[model samples]
Target chain A: MLYLSTISWLQEGPFALYRWNSLKEDLPLFFHAFLYTIGISLGALALAFVLGIFFGILSATKNKGAVFLSRIYVEFFQNTPLLIQIFFIYYGLPLINIVLPVYLIGILCVGIYHGAYIAEVVRSGIGSVPRGQSEAAASQGFSYWETMFYVVLPQAWRMMLPPLTNQLVNLIKNTSTIAIISGADIMFTANSWSSMNLNYVPAFAFAGILYFILCFPLAKWARHMEEKNKKAYSR
Target chain B: MIQMEGVNKYFGDHHVLKNISLTIEEGEKVVIIGPSGSGKSTLIRCINGLETITDGLITIQDIDVTKKEAPIRNIREKVAMVFQNFNLYAHKTILENLTLAPIKVKGIKKAEAEKTGMEYLERVGLADKAAAYPAQLSGGQQQRVAIARALNMHPEVILFDEPTSALDPEMIQEVLDVMIDLSKINITMIVVTHEMGFARTVADKVIFMDDGAIVETGTPEHFFTSTENQRAKDFLSKIIHH
Candidate 1:
C-alpha cells in the first residue's frame, strides 16, 4: 500500500518528483535545520556516551548495590516511551519549579533515555571479555580498578565499537522525537514545509532521504569494523 | 617460604582440596604431579590468595593467607603466577605485558620498567618480539613471554599451574627450557605439570596428589624410582610409558 502511494503520487503535477525544483530553494533552510538536529543529537550522544560508560562500568562491577542501582535506571528508562520521557522532563518538570530550556530538555531526554541502552551495550561488552584476563592482572598485584582499566576495558572497548556505533545511529534517529514537543529540529522544519506546500509525500520523503544521508556512512563503517574485528580476533 | 597447615577448599558441595599441610622453604623448587581433576592447580592457586582457603593457615614469609584484612596485594606482589594458557594481555605488546605489573603495582618508573622488562624478555630469548602483541607471537613465544612477565617482577616465589600443558608438543620444550633456567636462579617455585621429564630434571621435591590430598612427597629420585605407594606407582607408570 505504501509502495502504491509512492508510485501513484508521481502522476500528480505539483506533487510529482519534479517538485524538487521548487523545493530546491528550501535546501538552505533544511541545511540549517539539519545542523540543529545534528547539534542536538551530538550533544545528546556526548552526554549519553559519558553517562552510559559510567553506568555501564558500574553495572558491570562486582558490587551488588551498584549493579542493582544501575539495573533500576536501565529498566526505568528502557521500559518507558521516549515521547513520555521528553514530555516528563520538558513539561512535567515545570510543575515542580524545574524549568529547563527546550533544547536542553531535548538533549537530556535523548541522552539519558538512550544512555540506558548504551549501558546495556557496555555491560555486555565488558562481560564478553574472558575472566582470565582480569584474573591475570589481579595475580600481578594490580588493584581491582587497575585491572579493569588497563586489562579488561581495552579489549572490551574493541568489541564494543560496532555495537556502540549502532547506538549512535539510533540516538541520532531518535532526535526526531523532539518535534513532537514542537522543538525546532529537522522534522519540525519538514513539517512546516509540508504544511505550507501541502506536499506531505515529497516533503516527508525528502526528510527521510536526508536522514539516510546522515546515517548511512555510520552504518556502513560499523559493518566494515565488524568484519575487520572478526578477522583480527579469529587468530 | 610458604606454609599451608590443615588447608581445605571446597567448590560448592565438591571438595577440591582436603586437609592439606605442607611447607616450602625459600629457593625450593617443588613440582606437583597428578592426574587431571586431582586439585593440583587449586593447591598452588591458594598461595597467592588467587583462591581463598575455606579453612586453614597459609602463611607466605609470615603473611597469613586466611586473614581477610591482611594485605593480599602485598602477597601477590611477592608471589607471581604463570598460567597454562599464558594469559598475556592480548591487546598489549610483549614489552607492555612484562612492564605493566612492575609499573602499576610497584610504582616503577617507565624507563626502568621497560629496561627490566627487556632484560627478562632477552633472558627468555624473545627480546625481538618486545613490540609485538601477544596474539602475533607463536604459542611457545607467548608462554616464554608469560614467564618473562612473571620474572620481571623479581618475585620471592613463582607459581606455575600447568604452564606448558597448553602448548603444542614441540612448543613445550621452549617453555620448559625457560622454566629450567628459572629454577637455577634460586627463586622459590611450585610447578604443577604433566611433563614427568621436567619433574625428573629440576625439582627439589616431587609431590603426587590424588583426590585432593597429597599421596606422596619425595626427592626426585625417590619419588620417581623408589615409590612404594600403589597410587604413585600406578600414576608414574602410566605417564612414563605413555
Candidate 2:
C-alpha cells in the first residue's frame, strides 16, 4: 500500500493544466510525429485506393475466373486481423531473408488490409449503378472498358464517395496500430510521452484530438459531396 | 436492314421470345404493338444483339448477330437504340451524350462530332439544352436528346422501345413530334410502343404480338380496324381510345 496525500487528484501536482506547459517544449517533436502519421495514412490510402479499385472492378466483372480471383484476395485480407498482417510483413518477411523498413511495412500492411474493404465498397458501388447505363453505352457502340470508364465508373464514384471517406477515417485510426511496432507516428509519440512523464490521460487525450482533427474534415467533405451528387441527380 | 430467322430467346425457361421471324427493309418504319410480356421489345433487342438469342439467327445490315465472335461494337455502330427510360449518361451534358460515340467509336474528330451532335440536337429541338445534364431536362426533352444521340451515329436502323411510354401525358407530343420528323427522314426504324396514333400515321407495317409470338401482321389500318385475331382485337379495344 502507498501513502496518500491530502491533495485532490485533479488539482494535484503535474497532472493538471500546468502539465500541458511541460509538453510545450516537445511540441515540435509531436507535430513532426503528427506529420509522419499523416504521410503514412496518405501513402497507405493511395496504395489502398489503387488496389481496391482494381480488385473492385475485377470482382464486378461477369467473368467467373476474374471474379473468383478477386474474391480470394478480398476474403483473405478482410478476414485476417490488421495486427497479424502488420507483424507478418514486419517480422515474417525476414524469415525468407526479405527485409523492409518499418514505415514501408506499416504502409503495406495498412494498405492491403483496408484495400479489401475498399474493394467491397467499390464492387457494391459499381453494382449500384443502373444496368441501363451500361446498356445505353453499349448500344452507342462503346466497348466494355469504354463503357466502364466513361459512363459506369463516374456514376459509381459518386455513389462511392461516402463509404470511401468512411474507409479513410478508419484507415487514419488504424495507423495507430503501427505504434505496437515502435513506428514513429503520432500515436507512437503519445505512447513514449505517456510512459516517461506518467501522463497517460493527457497524452492519449491530445492524441485523440489530433486524430479527430485529421478525420473530421474528411467526414464533412463526404457529406458535402453526397449532398451535391443528390442535388445534381435529383429529378 | 434487319432480319431474324426463327429466333428464340429464353430467360431461364421462361421463353421471352419464340420463333421470331421478321424482316425490316431499309428505310421502312415498322411498329410493334403488344400487351406487356408479349416480347415485342425482346424481338427488337435481338436485332441489336442486346439480348442474346437462344437459337436461330439475327442479321443487321448483313452482319450476323448470333456469332459469338461477331464485333458487337461494329454491329452497334449501324444499330442504335432509344430506351423507354431515356438512358442518357447522367454525368455528361446533353452535347457530350450526343458527341461521345461519334468521337470515341467512329473516330471522328471532336470538333466534327460536336458539329454533327449540334445538328442533330437542332433536329430534336434541344440545341438550347446542350449544356444541360439529363436530370436538368424534362422527360420529353431527355427523350429528344436520346433521339439526337442515336442520330449522331448515323445508324441505318434505330430501335425505339416505348420512347413515349415514360413521358407525362402532356409531354408525349413533343417526343412524338421528334419521332415523326425522324420517320420523315426515311431512316429505318423499329418502334415498340403503345401509341397507336403514331403507328397509324408513320408505320409502313404493324406487327401485333401476344404471349411471345406474333399474333397478326398487317398495315396499321388492318391491325387497327380489321384484325381477325380475337386477342389482337381485345388488346386493341383495351388500349385504343380514339
Candidate 3:
C-alpha cells in the first residue's frame, strides 16, 4: 500500500515528469522535427555513399599514392570523434570565417564521418571477391576499370548490400548529433521541450521510439540480405 | 608464335622460374608437365603477361611482352587462357560470361558476340546451360563454359593451365574431351596438366620441368618411352603407377 501510493505520487504530484497534457500540446512540433531528421538523414546518406565509393575504389586500387590518400581520409575521419567533428564545423569554423548553415554542417560532418566506415565496408566487399575473378577478366583482355565495372563490382555489390544497409541505419541514428548544434532535429526538439517542462522521461522515450521507427525496418532488411547471401551460391 | 629467352621469375627471395628459354610455333600443340610449384603454370602465365618475368624477353607475334609500354592488351586479345578453377564470373549467366570479353575487348557487335558465344557453347555441348549461372552448374560444366568463353574470343592461341585438375574423377573426361576436340582446330595450344594420357594423345611437344628448370623437351613418344633423364623417369613411374 505504501509503495503504490509513492508510485502514484511520483506519477501525478509536483515531482511528476511525464504530463500527458503537455506532451499532447507539443506533438506537432515533434512531428515537424521528425520530418527534418528524415530530410537530413537522406541528404547525408547520399553524400556518404558517393564519398564511400570514391574512396573505396581508391583504396582498393594497386597504385601506392591513391591507396595512401584513401588511407589518410579513412584514418583521420574514423579516429576522431563525431562530436568533435560537429563542434569543429559548428563552432571552430566560425572563428576562421568559414561559417556554414546549421543543416549543412549537420549533413557534411555526419556524412563525411560515416563515409569512412562505409569505405571500409566497400573495400572489404571488393576484397571478398576471389582474385581469380579479376585475373580471368584480365586474361580476356579487359582493362582494370573494365574488369571492375563488368565483373568485380557486380559481384562485390551483392556482398556489400547488407553491410551498406546497416550503415544507412547507423547514418539515420547519427543525425541526432545535429541536436547539439541546436539544429531543429528530433533530439533537439526533445531536449528543448523536456528542459522547459522537466518531462525528460517521456521526451526521451518518444524520441527513442521515433528513431526505432526509422531504423528497425532497415536493420531487419540487412539481416534478411545477409541470410540470402549465405545461400546465394548453394544449389 | 610465342618465344621466351632466358626467362627468370622470383617471388621475393624464392626463385620460381630459373633461366629458361623456349619457343612455341604457330598452331603447335605443346603440353607442359611437372610437379606442383615447378613453374609450369608460371611459364604459361608469363607468356600472356599474367605473371611478370623478373628478367626475360617474351614476344608473341612480334609484340614484346617484356616492355611495359607495349600493347599487352593486344597480346591478351590474341591469347586466351582456361584456368584450373574455371574462374567463371559467378554473377553472370554462362552466355553473358562468354560474350563479355568479345564485346568489351574486341569491340565485337553485341549481336555478333552472342552469335559466336552460342556457337562456342554448342561446341562445348553446353548450349542448354547458357542461361545458367556458374554456381548452378557442375565443376565439369563450368569448365566447359570457360572453354567456350575462351573460344568466343577467337584467339590465335589458348593456354590451358591445369583445366581438368580441379574436376571430380568422373568429370575430368568431359573437360578433356572438349580440349581434345579443341586441339583438332588450327590454333596454338599450350597446356599445363598432369593428364599424361591427354598429353600422349594430343601434344606435339611435351616439356618436363623440375625445380624451376626445363629437365627435358621431347615428343610424347620420346618422353613416354625413351626419356633417359633420371628425374623424368622417376616422375613418369610415380605418375603412371598412381
Candidate 4:
C-alpha cells in the first residue's frame, strides 16, 4: 500500500522539483547551507571537546569537590532537552540584555549539551584502565598528575578514541537543531526553500543525504577504532 | 629501615590487619609466606603507603607513613614494589617504561636515565626486548621487564608481592631467577610469595601470617621445619605437599 501510494504521488503530485534543471538551480543554495552546517558543527565540536576534557578530568580526579562540581555540570546539561537549551540561549537570553549572535548561540548550546555526554565517555574511558596501572605508577614515586600524563592517559586514550568519535558524530548531526533559530544551516535551508517552491520531498531527502555524508564516515571510523581496540592488548 | 608499630587496617566492618608490629632492617631480605587472603600483601602494601592503616604507626627511615602530611612521595621514591601481574605500562615500550619514572620523578637527564634503564634491562636479561611492548612479551618476560623498571628507580627497598603467582609453571622460574639475582644486592627486600624454594634460597628472615596477624617470624630453617605456630604449620603443609 505504501509503495503504491508513493508511486501514485510521484506520478500525479506536484513533484516537478525532481526535474534536473530545477534541482540544478537549487544546488548552490543547498551547498551554501551545507558549508554553514559544517562551520557550526566544527565550532561546536571544538567547544564540546574543550569542556568535555576539562570536565572529564575533573570528574576522574580523587578530589570529592572536583568530582561533585563536574557531576552537577554533567547532570544539568544531560537531563534537560537540547531544544530547550537552544531556545533559552537564542530567544530568552535576549530578554535579559544578553543578545548573543545566532551562530554563537548555536555553538554554545549544542556544544555544552554534548559536552556532558563526552565528559561521561571520558570518565568511563579513564575508569576502564586497570587500577594496577595507577598503583604501579604511585609505587614508582610518580605524582598524581604525572601518573595521569605519563601512564594512565596514554592507555585511556586508546579506550577514549572510539567513543569520542561517536560523540563527534552526534555533535555534527545535532547542528541541525540550529535550524529552529534561523541559523541558515542545511535543515533551515531545506525547510525555507522547500516551503517556497513546494518541493518538500527532494529538499528534505537531499538534506538527509548531506547529513549522512558528514556523519557516516565518522561513525564508521568509530566502529573501526572499537574493533581495533578489542585486539589492542593481544600480541 | 622500616618499622610497623601496632598497625591495624579494616575494610569497613571487616578487619584485614590486626596489631601488626615488625621491623625490616636495611639490606635484609625478608620473605612473608601465608595462605591467600591472609593480609600478607596488605602488610607490605602498608609499608609503602599503598593501603593506609586504620590505626597505629608505620615509619620508613624515620618518615611517618600514617601522618596525613607525611612525605609519602619521598618514601615511595625509596621503596619500590613489584606486583603479581607485572603492571608495566602496556602503551609504552619496555625501555620507555624503565626510563619513565627516573626522568619524571627523579628529574634525571633523559640520556643518563636511558643509559641506566638499559643497564637494568640488561641485568634482567631483557635488554633485547627493550623495543617491545608489554603485551608482546610472555608473562615471565613482562615480569622481568617489571623488575627492570623497578630497579631503574635505584630504590633502597623493594617489595615483591607474589611476583611469580601469575606466571605459567614453565615461566615462574625465569621471573624467580631475576628476583634471586636481585637479592644479592645490598638493597632491603620484602617478598610475599608461596614459593618455599625462593624463601629458602634468598631470604635472610622469613615471616608467616594468618588471619591478619604475623603468626611466625624466623630464619628460613626455623620457618620451614621448626615453626611451632599451628597455623603456619598447616599453611606450610598445604603449600609444600602440593
Candidate 5:
C-alpha cells in the first residue's frame, strides 16, 4: 500500500538529508518546481474560470446551438482521461502546424480541458437557483439578461463559489499530469530526484505533501465558505 | 381593471381550466374557493402569466396579457403576486428582500426603497426584524414579509394563492389578519384560498370552482347558505363539518 511506502520514506528521510542536504542544490530545484507548478496551475485556472463561466452561461441560455456546443464540450473533456487529454494537446498541436510553446501549451491545455468540467460546476451553480427568482425578476419588468445579471446570478454566484473553488484545488492537483507530457512541472522535478537518488518513495511522497500544502488550505476554506453561505442563505 | 374572456387552459388535455370568463373591476376583492385540483390556482396564475392560457385574452389594466409583444413584464410589475409559500428571497434579509425589487425595477434610490420597505415591514409588525433572514422568521411571519414584499411594489392589483395553506393552525390568524387589512385598501385582488372564514369576512365576490369549472359565484352570505348548485352545497357542508 501507498501508506507503507510513505512510512518507508519517513524512515529514510534522515538518510536523504545526510546524502543531499549539504549540497543545497535539490532545495532550490524543489522550490523552483513548486513555483512553476503553482504558476501554471493558477494561469490555467484563470483561463478556465473565464471560459467555464462564459460557455457555462451560454449553454444554459435559450440558444439551442450554444447549449449543444457546450454540452459536447463538457462531455468530451469530462469523460476522457485528463492524462490522455494532456498528451493529445502536447503531441497533437504540432500536427496542426501550431507549435505551442512548451509551458504555455501546458497552461492552455489544462485550463481549456478542465474548463469543460468547470463549466458544468458553473452551470449547476446557476441552475440551483429556484425558478421563482427569475420569474419574480421578470415580473418586475427586467429583461432576461438583466434579470440574470442583477438578480439570478447574484444569488447563483454565492452558491457557486464553493464548487468553483473545489474545481480550482483539483486543477492544481491535476497539474501533475503535465509530467507525463514533458511540461517540467513540480512533479517532473520530483521524478528527476527519484531517478537521481533511486528513492521513488521519498520523492513521490514529498511531491504529494507539497501538493497538499498548496491545496489543503484552499479546500478547507472552500468547505468553510460553503457552510457559512448555507447558513446565511437558508430559507 | 382585469378581464379574462373565454380563457382555456389545459395540461396535455387534462382540461385544467375551461372557457373561464370573468371581469375584475379596480379595487375589487374576489376570493376563490374549491376542492383540490379545481383550477382555482390556475385561474389566478393565468392572470399573472404564471400559467399560460391555451385560448383567451386576459387584459390587466388595459394590457393584453395573451399578446407576447404587449409586455407581460409591464403587466406583472403593476400586479404583484404573494405566493402561498411566501417566496421571500431566502438569501436576503427581510429588508433586502423587500427593497430589491423596488430599487432594481422602479429605479428607486436605496434610501427611498429602504424607507418604503421599513414602512411595510412596520405594518407587518416585523420592522424590528428587518435585518433578519427569512429562515429566522415563523411561517406566518415569512408570509407577512411576502405581503410587505408585494405591497412595496405599490401595485394596482395583488394576487394571493392559498396564502394560509402552509401555516400552522395558531399561526393562520395573523396572516389572515394582514390579508383582512389588505382587503380594506384600494388595490384590486384575486385570492385563491380554502379559508372559508376569510372568504366570509373580506370577499366582495366568492367564486366556487369544481373540476376546472366555476360552480357558483355570489355574495358570501348567499353563496354560503343558499346555493342551488349541489356541488357548492356539498362543498360548504363538508368544509363546515370539518
Candidate 6:
C-alpha cells in the first residue's frame, strides 16, 4: 500500500515533465521508436501494395500458370500466422544462411503477411471493373496492357482506396507485434519504459495516444478521399 | 472487306457457331437478323477478332485472323465495333472516351486527338456532351457517344452488334439515325440488328443465321422478299409479321 502511493507520486507524468531534462532525454528515444514504427510499417505496406497489386493482376488473368502460382502464394502466406512467420524469417532463415539484416526481414515478414490479404482486396477491385469496359477498349484496338492500365485500373482504383487504406492501418497496428522479435519499434520502447519506470499504466497510455495520433488522421484522410472520388464518379 | 470461310466457334462443348460463312464487300452494308442465340452477333463479333473461331479462316481486309502473330491490332484499328450496351469507361468523360484509343494506341497528340474527338462528336451530334459522364447521358445519347468513339478511331469497317437492341423504342431512332448517317459516308459496315426496318433501309445484303450456321444469305430484297428457306421464311414471318 505504501509502495503504491510512492510509485504514483514518482510517476504522476505531469510532474515528470517539470524536470524537463530527464523527460527530454527519453523523448528522442521515444520519437526514434515512433519514427521507426511508422517507417517500417509504411515501407512494408508499400512493398505489399506493389507486390499485391502485381500478383493480384496475375491471379485474375487467363494464363493458367500465373493464376496457379498466385494462388499458391496467397494461400501459403494466409495460412501462416504472422508472428510465427516473422519468427521463421528472423530465426529460422539463418539456418539456411540467408543473411538479410533484421530490419529488412522484419519489413518483409510484415509485407508477406499483409500482402496476401491485400492481393485479394486488389483482385476483387480489378474484378469489379466490368468486362464490357475491357471489351470496349480492345475493340478500340488498345492492347491488353493498355486497356488494363488506362481503362480498367483507373476505374478499379477508386474502389481499391478504402480497402487498401484499411489494410495500411491494419499494417501500422500490426507493427506492435514486431516487439516480440526485438524490432526496436515503438511498442518495444513502451515496454522498456514500463520496465524502467515501474508504472505500466501511464507508459502504455502515452504510447497508445501516440499510435492514435498516427492512425486516426489516416482514417479521416482516407474517408475524405473516398468521398471525393465517389463524387467525381457520380458526376 | 471482311470474309468468314466455314468458321465454327465452340463455347465449351456447345457449338455457338457451326460452319458459318459470310463475305462483305468494300463500302457495302450488311445486316444480320435472327432470334436470340441465332449466332448473328457472334458472326459479326468474329469479324473483328473479338471472338476466336474454332475452325476456318477469318479475313479482314485480306489479312487472315487465325495466325498467332496476326496483325490483329492493326486489323482492329481498321475495323471498329459499336456494342448495343455502349460500354463507356465510366471513369472518363465523353471527350476522353473518344480520344483514349487514338491518343494511346495510335500515338496521336492530345490536341490532335481532341480535335478528332470533337469532329466525330459533331458528326454524332454529341459535341455539347464532351465533358459529361456516360452515366449522366440518356441511352440514346450514350449510344451516339459510342458511335463517335468508334468513328474517332477512323476504321474502314464498322461493326454494330445490335446497335438499337438495348434502347427504348423512343430512343432507338436517335442511335439509328447516327448509324444511317454513318452508312451515307460509304463506310463498310456489318451490322447485327433485329431492327428489320433498319435492315430494309440500310442493308445491301441480309444474312440470317439460326442454330449457328448461315441458313440464308442474299440481297435484302431477295432474302426479305423472295426467300423460301423454311427457317428463313419462318424467322422472317415471325420477326416481320409480328
Best by DockQ: 6
Task: Report the Cα lDDT for residue B101, model 6.
Answer: 91
Clashes of each: 0, 0, 0, 0, 0, 0
Candidate 6 lDDT tens digits, A17-63 = 33344545678887988999988887898889888987888898999
Say which candidate scores most in TM-score: 6
Model 1, B1: alpha-carbon shift in Å?
A: 2.6
Ten-residue region with minimum lDDT total, candidate 6 chain A: A14-23
DockQ of each: 0.44, 0.51, 0.52, 0.52, 0.38, 0.75
Residue pairs with colliding backbones in model 3 are none
What is the per-residue lDDT of model 6 for residues B85-202, given as tens digits with 9 covering 90 to 100? 9998899999999999988888889999999899999998889999999999999999999999998888898899988889999999999898888889869988998888888888
lDDT of 3 by residue, A61-88 (tens): 9899999999999999999999999998
- TM-score of model 6 vs. true structure: 0.94
Per-prediction TM-score to the true structure, in the order listed: 0.88, 0.89, 0.90, 0.88, 0.84, 0.94
List TM-score (chain A only) for every prediction.
0.88, 0.92, 0.89, 0.88, 0.84, 0.87
Arranged by DockQ with the best first, the candidates are 6, 3, 4, 2, 1, 5
Model 5: fnat (fraction of native contacts): 0.44
What C-alpha lDDT values do all the predictions have? Answer: 0.89, 0.90, 0.92, 0.90, 0.84, 0.86
- The best candidate in terms of lDDT: 3
- List residue ranges in candidate 6 displaced over 4 A: A1-24
Docking quality class, candidate 1: acceptable
In angstroms, how far off is A155's CA in candidate 3?
3.1
Report the C-alpha lDDT of model 4 over A1-235, residue by residue, as the tens digit: 7656766666645664254346578799999999999999998999998898789989999899999999999999999999999998787888999998888899999899999999998889889999999999999988787888788877898888987888888898898998998999999999998788777777888899999999998888888887887777544
* Model 5 chain A poorest 10 in a row by lDDT: A14-23
Which pairs clash inside model 6?
none
True contacts kept of each: 0.60, 0.73, 0.73, 0.75, 0.44, 0.73
Q: Residue by residue across B94-195, what tens digits does model 3's lDDT show?
A: 999999988889999999999989999999999998788899999999999999999899999999999999999999999999999999999999999999
